[model samples]
Target: MAKIKTIIDGIEVEVERDSWAIDVARELGIDIPTLCYHPALGPYGACRLCVVEVTKSKWTWLATACDLPIREELSIKTNTPEVIRSRKMAMELIMARAPRAESLFPLAEKLGVTKPRFKCRDDIGNCILCGLCVRMCDQIIGVSAINFANRGHKRIVTTPLHKKADKCIGCNVCVEVCPTGHVKTLDDGSFRHMQTWDADLEMLHCLICDKPYIPAKQFKVISDKLEGIELKRICPVCRRKETVDNLRYAVVEKVS
Candidate 1:
């Protein structure tokens, strides 16, 4: 509730108490790379790419910018030599686990991580294990459909028993939130298939156009939430067209 003054890269700024250091940095046009941070989800500090140097009196230490709370007179440096080194090391370790992941290439270049020192792993695919998908399903969607399965190096995101996830509504929230393109979905008119989770879902077709737009289960979840909205079985495109046509008719009637 209260505002506090903090210094980021020698630029003093006033922000709300308990505000994340990363948010303030970005407000000042400072680029702090992050993989696990989502506006709708809580900070997990999984990727460690957003590490920054925090100076409090005589003590100086590296802290995750995503979860670092801003306090009065807090001093932070995002691109110091130590911070860059830590980020480079973290990126190398992440790249080794997902060497073929194209999404990591830009960040790797920025950090000067030419090649990972560790052995490249082909088993994990592009998953950095940031837990964004899992948390989105559990915290926001409340589905709890997919989760981290194995332990240690064998850990992976999968459905229960590695079979069809009955609870999956085909909302594709996981796919949208995933920093890497690991959780893939394919819509083949008739079915929406989540290849990663091995789940097959029936598509919900638009009533007027007869084209599949979303999964049936996902529609039901949305319709249930809006109990008295009188939801029409129309796709977004058709809905927008209909709204415009109605507005035109109303304007004509008023002019006449």
Candidate 2:
């Protein structure tokens, strides 16, 4: 490991090169607040909450600690007046767009931000579009079911072609990874559906038989009776033959 020297809160600290500034700070017992920085996923630096002033040789600028790599002879200032102001502003902006939950209130108080300064959007509640959920689903889980669509203020997360997503495995990994409870999973009698800021699942019907095969998760409660049954896009006649054949083969193997 290469030696990395950096200044945090005017104190010199040495770290391993290629380590993130956030990890370095944590080692030094300095807390840098962040929202989208997950250890399991790549840092997008979208939240802008962990910005810190860094001076490396001649170049000096604000960089995100979550994304910045420590180098030799790097100086980092994490708790200056300017840094505190910027952090407070970022927290206020995020709070304005987030739900008024009890968890956020104490954090706001700790950051010295009493109230939000900007106008709150009507659609703003839980999600800040930090891309943590999307990155985890795409990079970690290898399921590209959800992504950002549109642009700027009109931007929203959606499935491909803005159509009902057929690739979602109902794994609920997205929900578990989200920092805010923006994505919710509800169980209907036929299947489990997820609700997020941008989209909802549509009721599914069998194309060949025109039977109501799946209801929206928010509409009905799933019962334990239908737990192991797989709901595929097939009619009862096709499913009966497949199930019977599998059972027959299992019985023959047991006897043999």
Candidate 3:
């Protein structure tokens, strides 16, 4: 396997070649903060919170750790004063755009953002414009229902023509990954609702326990892939318990 010798915080560490700074940092037990970079998705450097200082051959500059590729003899400083200042600025900027993002408060405090200095644009709403939802819909699920629309401060993520997209499979992956609560999956125990895209999918109850487990659309997607193999309509817990009970009964019958 290809490898690269990198120096991080004055310690020599070896990591896989072509790996990003986040991957190398993680391998060295370092936790680099990230917002738009999900393990299941490609690196999108929309959030500049992971900025880090890198020096190679007397040249030094800051780069986003999530997208910065690992190179041979690369030296990185994740907690330098300059890096801290840049990260704090990025946090404040994101906070300004997403003041109602309760999920960001912890990170904001960690990055030394007491209060955002930028003016709040209520017209922009609470989204940080990270594009995680759009990327997930396009890359993972193969459904490009939503995308970044407009330009600059006018930019927003929404379905085409700002209407409910019919191609959406009702997967809540977008809502699940959104660090800011901008995307919503509202459920009142009967239906799984994607509020932004206006997808109201009926939730399916478990056959064994009759508790709502999955959305009908999501289930249909999975079942369609499986073809003739009919999946059991039981939640994970009930499935395990039923399997154990059936096994016990079979063992008793064999012994008899």
Report the lDDT of model 3 for residue 2. Answer: 76
Best by lDDT: 1
Per-residue lDDT tens digits for candidate 3, residues 77-159, read: 99999999999999999988888788889989999997899996676667999999999999888778899999998899989
Going through the candidates in the order shown, the clash numbers are 0, 0, 0
**In candidate 1, what residue range of length 10 has the lowest lDDT sum?**
66-75
Clashing pairs in 1: none
Candidate 2 least-lDDT 10 residues: 216-225
lDDT values, one for every candidate: 0.91, 0.73, 0.87
Per-prediction CA RMSD (Å): 1.2, 9.6, 2.1
The weakest ten consecutive residues by lDDT in model 3 span: 119-128
Model 1 Cα displacement at 233 (Å)? 1.5
Clashes of 1: 0
Ranking by lDDT: 1, 3, 2
Of candidates 2 and 1, the better by TM-score: 1
Per-residue lDDT of candidate 2, residues 76-178 (tens digit): 8887777888888888887777746445677678889887888766585577778887887788766678898889877766778877666665557778876
